[model samples]
Target: MSDQSSDASSRPGASLESGEAAGAASGTVPEPVSEGPGRAKAAEEKPARASTRPVPAQNAGPEVPKVPAYLQAQPRPDVWLRGGHQPPPGVLTRLRPPSPPVIGPGTLWSVLATALLSALLLGDGLGANLLIVAVPAALGAFFAARSAARRLRPWTAVWAVGGLALLAIPALREAGWPVFLAVVSALALGSLALHGSRSWPGVLLGSLGLFPSVAAGARWGWRGVRVRADDSRGRVRTAVRTTAVAVVLLIVFGALFASADAAFADLLGDLTPDVSIGDSPWRAFLFAVGLVGALAAAYSAAAPVRWDGITVRPGKARNRAEWALPLIVLNLLFAAFITLQLVVLLGGYDKVLEETGLPLAEYARQGFWQLLWATVLTLLVIALALRWAPRGGPGDRTLVRSVLGALCVLTLVVVASALRRMDLYVDAFGLTRLRISVAAVELWLGVVLVLILAAGVFGARLLPRAIAVSAAAGVLAFGLVSPDGLIAEQNVQRYDADKTIDIDYLKGLSADAVPALNTLPEPLRSCALENFERDLARQEAPWYSSSWGEVRARDILEKHPAQNHGTECYSLGQESDERDGYEEDSYDPY
Candidate 1:
């Protein structure tokens, strides 16, 4: 803690710098050796300045200057640099002191409570369940960082909450499972990485590899609990163990006796239970383990250990021939493909389909995914090329730039093709949530490609920042559009054009679709309403699982009395109000 300058001599085993320094330390004038035959031979090598030159230090090691901790040796280059020999060194690696234990009693108790809450709230409708989960999850990060003496990046928390909102949003839940997963995963990465690792990409990679930490944290928690519970007297531990053994024996004998006697079985009834583990525990044991994992995941998220994230490969300069040949060839092929696409576009869809002798639906389904994959792979190729492209020579740079520009331009055509495919498919077969999402993704990809091209050509280099923003924007747009409602609207539009409305399918959509279905025309609306009412009736939301979606669904169904004509579950004039007087009493809010 004291401020004192550190120097080389203080460090044991450090090499001595000069004879003068050693002489100074000893305060002695050393006597010179006699000029023997060896001295004569050495003198002959430096005859011009033999006497003037300082004699080599006798038995002295080479001098090494002291360096402060903050002033370290030069970090190793990234792997991509110099075209690979060995893997890049861990640039951020440091032998840091072990972090002090976080002593936040509030944090510890809150995380434990969160684990219990998560366990209690499982199997509820996703909206409510996710809402409940996010609170503790976010708090977990805050607490963990606090414990580790790290600061939480505000934007990371913002993104995490935004993602959780997407999950909780009623209508948007049907935006496609994969889309939701991506948003949630991004949220997790942003939150964990905000304080977990040193670099953005590193945080991302490490966040995915956090299972080990989670397991360790859980084990740590359990160890902590055990350490506290084992009193020095040993009596408390002994009594607990004895009681546990007795309980197991009693349960085993009781079950056997009940099985032997039918009368006793009837008396025991539900108490005998259907599920038991090792004749000792109830099914609650499974629930307990789940709580443990949840606690572990939360603990690791909030207070992660030190992680050295992935070191990106260094960029290496390449020969002009290496950079030019592949890019030029690829660009030419892309140019040709794009030219053909443009020609076909001018000729119209019907004419092209006629030439190919294919049905509209089949043709429409063909190109969307392929074009998407090609565009994604194209970006990958551009990235790898950029990493290895030559940095020296104007001719090589110009060639790279020209080819890159052409490839980006051609890639736009491919993105457009993908969009067109989705459009054609939707036009022919009507829209679903997945189709709408695909179209949106395609549009976003187009915008991103435009950004990429602009950055590449103008030297703006906005790809990294642009990519994250554009992707998040695409997902947030889904929230704006309202997936369940959009699906209903598009399907209804399709029905209007060509009498093909599927009421059952519409009813089958999430609760978010309910309000939209209510807007449908006449008798059809009534049938859809009946289907939804019956379905919702069967999916009774337990009190703990109450969500905005469920609550609203309940209120809406109450307002729209099923006409009872379409549903087999209800007869004419049936009340159908079994849950009318139910209380939300299971949970204690305080």
Candidate 2:
């Protein structure tokens, strides 16, 4: 027995094995030894401590501490564990989930003030009230951003001015839908600009995710209000108290005075707000919209999403020959098309007309929409080519810039061709709203292509924002020009020159066209102005809801009232109601 014990103690790792065996028998956790140079010394010292403890019966091991089952179900620890190992202390508590952002008093006041302003200024239908409400809303956003301690980007000033200009469109135009779209876009741009969003994806999200952000802002604002409610010293609480007191005083005193005298009651009736119970829901809706919009802007400004941090993987670049070949082929095609256009423009149209046996109007109509679509497709092609273009060296960049720049220049020519065709078509078959709107779109597209070419010359870092700005500018220009009015003026001029007019088509125009329509001959004038005058007779817009366009149309109609001559005007039947076949031709691939 002594020899066997001596043999066991003489074995390698004998101390560590005995210590671990002792720990297992005792059910006491063994201390971990330090790795490296200290490990041998620790192993040597461990058995001395183990030997001093009294040996226990196998079944009489020390009691393991009772951990509750709920406590046993702790979070998964980061480090791997061997059999019988416990996680380090406080691991579970350290891994608790973080809380969301806390909204504050300044943000709360900005939201409340903006909501109240919206309730007072924007009742229902838009007018100068749009501009009035916009000013306060913008001011709210400015102050909110300031309160959040966010620095406004220099670009924000441009968007602020642009938003104000877009809001002015509602006051100037009688058209509702266009103005509505402009206002929505303007708001989106303003919100995005507040955050200094730079990427295409960011711009798209800022525009499309606007309502979702509003809801998020509302929740954030509610959290702020709740948090502030707990603190008596909060400014929000003080403001609420003051407002409640003021409301009580006004209700008590105003009622006593209103009941005291009939004259005072009449004066009270005049001085009292015109809001009705029926308008309460709508006004509340507007108030919420204002609150959410301002909150969205402020929240975004404070904690703007790092959208530019998203990395876009460029398409696999082809070798020079592989990349250059397709682009060269495309450039040749564009050159060929441009050559044909130049031929037509340089007075070779006569020969083409003789060969096709079609009149100038037919020739122009057949090709205008096609050219417009081709120009759009060319832009897509250029975008793809740039995406995959080789950037291996200066030679590659030069090749890309040369080829894409040529493509853009050719596209501009195509734009001009499309516009020329529209002009010819309009001259032959009088200008209509569709023709004018398409012309505007084509013009704006031309502007975009020019911008692209400029981007290629300079760095393209700002290309997305520049394109967005151009689109905003185009919409603003389109709205301010009043296409309906322009259409009326152009058609009237065409009628004078060619003794032809689409009076039926003209009759459907809005009151913005009244000044131009009023210049027509007696029966035509009365016929065209019939709807305009009737609308004016029915309109009872209050001062806040009255637009500049409506005011002008009313004055014009009052000066030259319609003679109720639509029946006689219809009998003339000199103008064709078929308008133009552009819609049918739009589907034609050619």
**TM-score between model 1 and native:** 0.62
Error of 2 at 307 (Å): 1.6
lDDT of each residue in 173-238, candidate 2, tens digit only? 887656876788688777666656677766666554345456556676777667667775566567
TM-score leader: 2
Looking at model 1, how many pairs of residues clash? 10
Q: Residue-wise lDDT of candidate 1 within 370-485, one digit each (tens)?
A: 88888889888987888898888787777777788788888888898888878877766567767876778778877877887777666644355455556666666666566777
- lDDT (C-alpha, whole model) for all candidates: 0.60, 0.75
Per-prediction TM-score: 0.62, 0.78
Give candidate 2's TM-score. Answer: 0.78
- Candidate achieving the largest lDDT: 2
